[model samples]
Target: MTHQTADATDHPTVAALVARSNRLGGDPRNTNYAGGNTSAKGTAPDPVTGQDIELLWVKGSGGDLGTLQPKGLAVLRLDRMRALADVYPGLDREDEMVAAFDYCLHGKGGAAPSIDTAMHGLVDAPHVDHLHPDSGIALATAADGEALTREIFGDQVVWVPWRRPGFQLGLDIAAIKAKNPQAIGCILGGHGITAWGDTSEECEERSLDIIRRAEDFIVSRAASRDAHPFGPQRPGYEPLPDDERRARAAALAPVIRGLASFDAPQVGHFTDSSVVLDFLARERLLPLAELGTSCPDHFLRTKVKPLVVDVPTSATVEETVTALRAAHAAYRADYAAYYERGAAAARARGEEPPAMRGADPTIVLVPGVGMFSYGRNKQTARVAGEFYVNAINVMRGAETISTYAPIAEDEKFRIEYWALEEAKLQRMPAPKPLAMRVALVTGAASGIGKAIATRLAAEGACVVVADLDLAKATAAAAELGSADVAIGIAMDVSSEAAVQAGLREAVLAFGGVDLVVNNAGLSLSRSLFETTEADWDLQHNVMAKGSFLVSREAARVLVDQGLGGDIVYISSKNSVFAGPNNIAYSATKADQAHQVRLLAAELGEHGIRVNGVNPDGVVRGSGIFASGWGANRAAVYGVPEEKLGEFYAQRTLLKREVLPENVAAAVFALCSSDFSHTTGLHVPVDAGVAAAFLR
Candidate 1:
């Protein structure tokens, strides 16, 4: 793998490596999460000696190579790292290896080097890139992988059997490369493939070339014996129609979501993309999908084998969910046995037995329906979903060429429970209280509703921005974050049909609703003597009636799903203390405050917590003010309209203007586990107004 050229400049070399690494990183079929790493060797002046020393700039730990930056590549003295081969022979623990890697650091580069730094250092080429391409992994993990490698690549590639990644593994790779000096790169069985050359472009070309060969091999074989598109089917079996299959999937979605979540605040979302449904439609789906990860790199995310739910032919949706529940139980029991088998094997080999991970399956495959990926958050779930697609492609390719044989179960367990890999999982950030929980925020386009939606999203909830103005709602959702994080829809809460339809859309998008903020309202400030019948109806229709409709519809979805949820109404300080020229606004708010109490009493038995946030003086960009309520209120107080915000800020005991964010904070507190056991509570966010405090 060694090459040196006088024409090579550091700028082009680094640029080429970064570009190639990003291309691979961006494609899930090539790599996932942070699974693969890339490196390029160049000469640098030693700071102290001022001597030219060769350094390996490799992808660092915990950063995705797809978005790799120059700083993300740790610089290590290649000569010093390669020398660790002698030291590795005597080391038995990972800590010692890590210490040796640290000692090899060439500069004050603060990036934590990947554990594979030593392995990359051993590659004989200046530009090296390792990838876990689905095709490469498919051929690498098969039972006859060595023979296939010899047949397909001939003497171009060196084949090394699986060795737990560490100092010893790096040493083994170095030894193989030394023996096969002219070989392009080596294929690490049950792992991944690597390619190296004088230029980053050459290395990338070589790696992709090998991947294409494997892909071609599979295509050729499948084409020659192309008898069944659905793979080998069971005797006398026929797959259900696509529409029927999808119908079953939709029916089972809520139940699958429930099973994926924990009793705590955690919730796991599910997705059944096209590839998943296509895979589920395959013949002999259970055995093929159960072959485990295509390579060891996938173990950290998808687990050893997906949970397969057997959907018997001619089964109804109810029967399907019942079967899924029972299958989940059996899956847990099987996982226990699998863990025990691996632990005993480790003990026999005189290695420290690793602790068992959670029994919940990250990937779920249901026959006659579709696959389900469960993760604490949507991104992780999508990763699982993406890798599962990779696995299917790998398996299908391998099955077409020969009998599909992934690494043994024991090998899968070793990687799944490896301490370093476990550390990666442990380093994931602690989840926010509302992580993955979906909330519907009415009037989220602006004002207090917008603040509440933003806060909820920051705490990890996916917010649906429901407002009367479709454009504003859409724009607000976009401003908050990605569509996955926040979506928007038009909902005139006063209309019963519109409220019901809006709630339905929310449920459709997020599986089911967990929280609702009835914050959409307007102020009609006409005095009782001058107020028309329309003024009273308009205010009541939006505030009081609107609150009832949204609550009833959202509560129906929550209760039907049997998942305890929260509902909050945006009442006002006027509800507790009426003000001059505010009859219509004050009376309607007061009515809803009482409604909150009544609904809380009724919904409590069903684990639905109903509460209210009463905020005053949120005058900046207030919809009420924009609708002409502020000028009238200022005139009543004999103050100019422009001074209203300041006047209200000075009136509070804290002398802090009550912003919508303040009200949002209170609403978040009520909706979170902090108030899990407390409901029917009206929290004020007016900065200590004596008149507005609840009795």
Candidate 2:
């Protein structure tokens, strides 16, 4: 897709539109992570006809307004779109309309236009901004939302009742505009706000000003009254003490995440941010919080209503999990019933309802703790969390001003199953293999561990970089990518206490572990006669003892979470193909080889698989080489240390250099379902080393 430069040198209209769109997109109060759309209409050179034609530059589907560039906006011939609207005048045939939208594209290398293009095109203005603003939706979805809008803005804005957004909504907008020519904007009931102006700045300023007015109305009323926002007003409940609330949230996150994973193997992410915590702390508002989302636009992200569970006041993990699982089952059953009811209502109205969506609750509300959001991946979870936060804010504001009310149940169903939203979802890429799973890699500061961690994160798994050096681990995690994808922690695997504490920290940070890579090791090339006791002790502690400690601790968590998991050890080829002067390293690796088999036998019943990878002559970026063991290894082979990598590569049957990435690939394969049926097996990533082949 072509990206428009944010340069001010473009046509004044495009430049102004880009500037204002970016400004609105940048602020969460206006737009969330790519949640809103912006557009501008102006005359542009028509390629087909040597004439200036009215064209609409609108935010493309999936484009983030905050970082929008010129290429991010699709340009369409307004005359063509307006005419197409007349062709399908009475009702919306969604697929046909979307295809027609694609056929009207006038810009080169632009992404797909947003489904809301019709509404923007129908609004006769130089600039239009449509956003799911919290304050705006608060006033739009209130019990007396129309009255509130009239009282707050009077004829300044028009109220458009809830309609599934499509060609029909565009027609309604046009009709509304024709009657209320002086209105600056229109509030879509249980949806969002759409504002227009003769110029880009005027439209943007008007939108912001309207939102500010709503904010003021809510705040002023809240300060005047002691009653809850939603009535039959209940007495205000004091918040839980900070320490107890934090402790409760921490203890309950894993259980909630685990329960959310009911049928899935991967536990989802959690959002215990201060906003969520404060909302949860208000014990009296728990009932209202379970009502539903603030606006219908949030339906796709958070479902109809969050599944509410009892506050884990002083509960144990086992107790919480049991309660949560029961609550989750009940929630799913209720969701199924709710859908059936909506479907029956649609049929009773003589309208065929769309297909049913998944019954799982995306947002889970725990009264005493905090809210938790679930998604197939981290980004989805974050986006859902953001929408829920906005919902909470809007609900609070509306309640403080007047009784809070979302759209009716039937409208929720229509919005949640809107064909336009479904089409957008259909365009998304299929999820990767490691999506949503969490992996922990010890000694991830560099080499094989680093490669494994990076690969896992790239494949969509959240990674934990555990290393003895916190600084190096932190830097390494940063390099892997976003903080949501990976985190770095300090841990010396050889220390039992450190390993235990590190696992606890990891569990709290990422919900629970689904995969563990036991890769920490120390190398020494001392012959049996020359091997020192210290060398033997150190090698065994890190390689054998360390892997065991990590494996045992990780197993405990996986068992507790009750989700099947994978554990892979990065043992050495030396364990299978012993060479001269490698006594300490070889023996410890052999110990790990046997350890993997024994642990696999023990963990199989718990649904935890154990495996190992034996990598030979990964000398190029070997931590062993960095520690000066390459010279000692080269001395044994009668070659220069610098040539050892080449020597090993040439000696292998494949004559290929076995890099750290190759070993990481093997670890990933063993961890994934590719080798799911087999455990206690050690795969060799040594470019086909004949001597290292297991018998």
Extract clashing residue pairs from model 2: 2-71, 3-71, 4-69, 4-70, 4-71, 229-399, 229-400
Q: For residues 224-314, could you state the per-residue lDDT of candidate 1 as single tens digits?
A: 9856434655432234576565555545655666665533332334445665665665576777766677576576678788888776547
Give TM per candidate. Answer: 0.89, 0.92
lDDT of 2 at 202: 92
Residue range 1-695, candidate 2, lDDT tens digits:
23432222386777878899889988888866777788988876655555677888888888888988887888788889888866883663553686788777774626687778888888777788888888888887788888889999999898898776777787788788778988988888877888888988899998898878888988898889975554332223223466665555556665666677775644455666766655665544557666787565576788878887663445555676677889889988988898898888868866676777567678887654566787777667767878888888888877777667787787787666666677777878987889879899999989889999989988879999999899999999999887778889999999999998788767766777889999988788787888999999999999899999999988877876777889999988888996888888999999999999999999999788999999987787778687879888889888998889899999989998889899889988987877879889999888888888998
Q: For each candidate, what is the lDDT? A: 0.78, 0.80
TM-score of 1: 0.89
- Per lDDT, the best of the predicted structures is 2
The global Cα lDDT (0 to 1) of model 2 is 0.80
Per-model clash counts, in order, read 2, 7
